[model samples]
Target: MTVSGAARGMLRTEVDRSLKTFLDHQRAVGGGPDVVPLFDAAEDFLAGGKRLRPAFCYWGWKAGGGGDDPAVFTAAASLELLQASALVHDDLMDNSDLRRGMPAAHRRFQALHEKEGWNGSAEQFGAGAAVLLGNLLLLWSSEMWRTCGLPAEALAAAQPAHDHMRTELMCGQYLDLLEQAHGENTFESALRVALYKSGRYSVERPLRLGLTLATRGAPPWTDALCSDYGTGVGIAFQLRDDVLGVFGDPSQTGKPAGDDLREGKRTMLIARTLAAAPPEAAAVVRRLLGDPALGAEGVATLRTIIQESGALAACEEMIKQYLHDALEALERAPITTEARTALADLAVAATTRDT
Candidate 1:
């Protein structure tokens, strides 16, 4: 493997190990039978993710002159829990049925309720369980970060960025809900949602956290570099998700084709399509967008509209432009050559279909 590839592999392995250890500790602490299912759900949801956030944090630490240390890996791995927390809540908010080709947390609980012939509404039970599960993951993420055995001083330095990441993500989630409810989505509004909802937490703040941890007295220039490069990569990452929601392989993406259309995401990709499409085509999109029982025929029609309208190509170009900007920021970053290569690889992974 190349250096970057090896680093990613190591990150995947170490983060997985750290998460396993933490979850195991939780299990050993003992919970009631009712909560066992929640624990099981947490374990299932936490397993086998891409671990993208932690990788960015790890590479950020490397860039800041931090040495190889498993404690840093443990600390970085906490990001996986935070990410899982966000996704669980996001899936519930979107009413998504599946996650990674398995039933979503809410759906899983709904099934359990139905199986048990519970008295309350299965849907309500599922929704409530999902909310609690998401909260559980968030709590676990905080605990993991605190007990990662890092120096108190170092953790203290990174705490502000960590707090900002959590706070910004919640604000972003609120913005997403507001956008969906109002149903008046401009490209600019969609971009703001993307940046606040996914961008800062996914890449920017994680990088900032790592940088701060490594350089307790980090320079202003380093912070600027993290913002510029990380924001570009983060926004491009969400844009890639926009494309995947429409055109991705079900097996690869762990969701049905055109699920985003069914969910009425109102992504920038869709906004751009509407901007460039003919009046009739735009009307067709408006007519078909958000049908809960959207069929393959509907999906195909929307796909044709997106492609023929040049929205897909336009989104692709935007991703390229953002990636180009992110990489250019790297040119001015004062980091090791290896760190640069790893961060570049990560940026590409964030933007491309492959990861």
Candidate 2:
């Protein structure tokens, strides 16, 4: 099989096994009537995600010379739990209803509340349930890490990186919220959010965590190499996501067309479009950019304005530059040739993939 095929197979196997274990554990813990339903809802929400973070963690571990032991799988699985927690909170914050082609956690809970004729505000119940469930997932993630059979020294070394990842993500999320609320976003600010929110947590820290876990003491250059590689790939990944948010076919993406536009995401593409649009076009864009009530026709018009403003081309260029830098960094790293090649291929697949 091709490398991509092999990676997909590995990811599928790991995700399936991890999810089964997680579900079995949940079942064994059998909370009372109310909480049991909540657990079921959480499981349903977690079921359909792409498991991208865990796959990244797994491959990062392999690249850092870690074997495919059960401990490694558990460690990788922790990242997926973290991802689930983040998504649950993210959807609530975004007021989003759909995720991975199904009702979001909060939405599912709300529907269940209504279906069961519960005597409470379904919205309140849903949000509260989702928040508690998300916290549970976060706790579970930490526990998974604690139980992974790595040496204490390795765990100690990884703790700071892990903390930094979570801290940066929270900060980035807050920054994004602030920008959207105040209409204070700029291209630079968007780039900063992308780096901290998606870049570090999504790629950098995972690579660093895997490296720390694998080696008794990683060389000084190891962290630097991973940083360079991670930043490049992470930036490319977010940019591609931004593109897909607007231009991708909804069938494959499992999102409504122009969902990001509807949400008024302060993405790099939007910033660039605003910056480069003609004066008249800029006014129109600014007026309609984040309007949640925008219709499909309005979204089409905004897309046209962005395309005509040259922002799309600019974003594409930036993606290519990042991909080039990532390849260069990979070449310079002291990892095995096969590992480096695998990383390169994964990077390409990540950035160039349509879904």
Candidate 3:
């Protein structure tokens, strides 16, 4: 394996070990029978992720001259809990049925209700259980961070960024919900949602938090450079998701084709299509955009309109630009060469992947 690949493997192993240990400890000592399913759901949900956030954290620490340490891995893995919480809540909000190719947490709970012939509305019970489970994961995110054995000073430095990340993530989510509700399809608005909802939390905060934990006093230039890199890559990551939502193969993405259309996400692609297409064509798009009953034929028609309107090309160009800017920031970063190369590889992967 390449250096970055090996490091990633090691980090993944460490994170899995630490999470299992912590969850097992929780299972052994905490909660009643009602909460056991919550713990099980968390473990299962956490087991299948790509661990990208933790990888970013680990590489950020290395860039800040951190040593090879298991403690950093444990600390980095805490981000997974935060991600799990966000996804569970996001799935609920989107009313999505699947995650990572499995029934989403809420749907799983709903199924459990049906299997056991439990009384009460199955959907409501599932939603309530999922919400509580999401809450549990959020709480555990902080708990894991605090117990990761980092020095008090390090935790103190990292706390502000950590806190800001959580707040910003929720605010972004609110923006997304607001846009969906209002059917706001403006490109600028979509960009704003992407920035707040996924970009900062996914890239900037993780890098900042890692730097704060790994070093007592990084130079201002280094911090700024990391921020620039993170922002560019993070935005690119979201834009890529927008593309994948529409065009990605279901086998790779683990979601049906045109899932975003069904969800009525006002992504930049849709915005651009609306702006560039003829009025009648745009009307067709707007009409069919959010229908949950939209079938494969509808998806194909919309995809053709988006493609012929040049919106897909436009979004792809923007992704390339942001990725270029991110790599440029890496070029000027004052980190070690190994760290720089790894980060650049990660940034590229973030932008240029099918899943």
Candidate 4:
């Protein structure tokens, strides 16, 4: 395997181990047959991500000259829990049925309600349970970070960045919903959602958290790296994810084909397509974009419109440009040579990976 691939694999292993160990310990507080499902749902949701957020955090620490301490890994792995919280809420909001080929938390709960022949509305029960589960994961993420065994000084230094990240993510979620409600899929609005919801939360904040923890303080250059490099790479990563939601194979992505279309996601790709598509094609998009029953033919038709409109190519070019910008920023970052190389590799992988 390539060096980058090996590094990612090993990092994934360590992050998974840390998270599993934390969850296992938390089982006591949640020790009951009834609460088993919540923990099970958390585990299933966290099981299969690429661990990119934690990677960014880990590399950020390395950039600040931190060594391989298990405590750092423990702290970094908390990103997974935070990310899982976001995904659970996201799936619920989108009414998505699947995640990584498993029933979404809401759907899982829904099925459980039906199986037990509950008295009230199964759908409502499912939605409530999913919300509670998402909140629980969020709580656990903070707990994990606070208790990751890092020095008090280091933790205090990183706490603001950590708190701000979650707050930003939550506010971004609101912006997303607002955009959907207002039908505000303009390029600028979409970019705003991209920045707050995915970009900063995914890479920039995590990197800052790492750097602060490693140095026991946030260096001025850390802001430079987070802005120029982390934000650029993070936006590219979200853009790539937007493409995969439509064009990627369901087997690889764990979501159904054109799932984003069904959700009516106002992604930059969709925005670009609207800008570039012929009137007739744009009309077709408007007609079919959000129909819950969008079938294979609809997906194929939308795909063709996206391709013919040149939006797919446009988005791809944007990814390339953003990646270039991120690399240029990394070139200027005053970090170890090893960290620079790893961050560069992470930028590529974050933007290009299918899953």
Provide the overall lDDT of each model, using Cα atoms, as 2-decimal numbers: 0.90, 0.80, 0.89, 0.91
Candidate 2 lDDT over 1-355, as tens digits, reads 2366776777768766876686677678767676787777667766776666676666677677877676777777788778888888888888877777788889888988899998979999899988988888888888877776766887887787777887888887788788788775688888887887777787777777777777646777677767788889988888888899888887887777888888888899989988898999988988887787888998999999999999999999999999999889888887777667777877887788777
lDDT of 4 by residue, 100-141 (tens): 999999999999999999889999999999999999999999
TM-score of 2: 0.94
Better of 1 and 4 by lDDT: 4
The lDDT-based order of candidates, best leading, equals: 4, 1, 3, 2
TM-score of each: 0.97, 0.94, 0.97, 0.97
Q: In candidate 1, list every pair of residues with a backbone clash.
A: none
Which digits, one per residue and each the tens of the lDDT, describe model 1 over residues 212-325?
889976798677778789999999999998899999999999999999999888889889888999999999998898898999999999999999999999989999999999
Cα distance off (Å), candidate 2, residue 167: 1.5
Query: Can you tell me which runs of candidate 2 are displaced by over 4 Å?
Result: 1-4
Cα lDDT of candidate 1 equals 0.90
The Cα error of candidate 1 at residue 307, in Å, is 1.1
Q: What are the runs in model 1 whose C-alpha is more than 4 Å off?
A: 1-4
Question: Tens digits of per-residue lDDT for model 3 on 1-355?
Answer: 1355577687789999989988888899877897777888999999987787888888888888888778888889999999999999999999888888889999999999999899999999999999998999999999999999888888888898899999999999999899889975688899999899999899878888888888856678667866789999999999999999999998898888898998898899999999999999999998999888889999999999999999999999999999999889888988988888888888888899898
Backbone clashes, candidate 4:
0
Count steric clashes of candidate 3: 0
What TM-score number comes out for model 1? 0.97
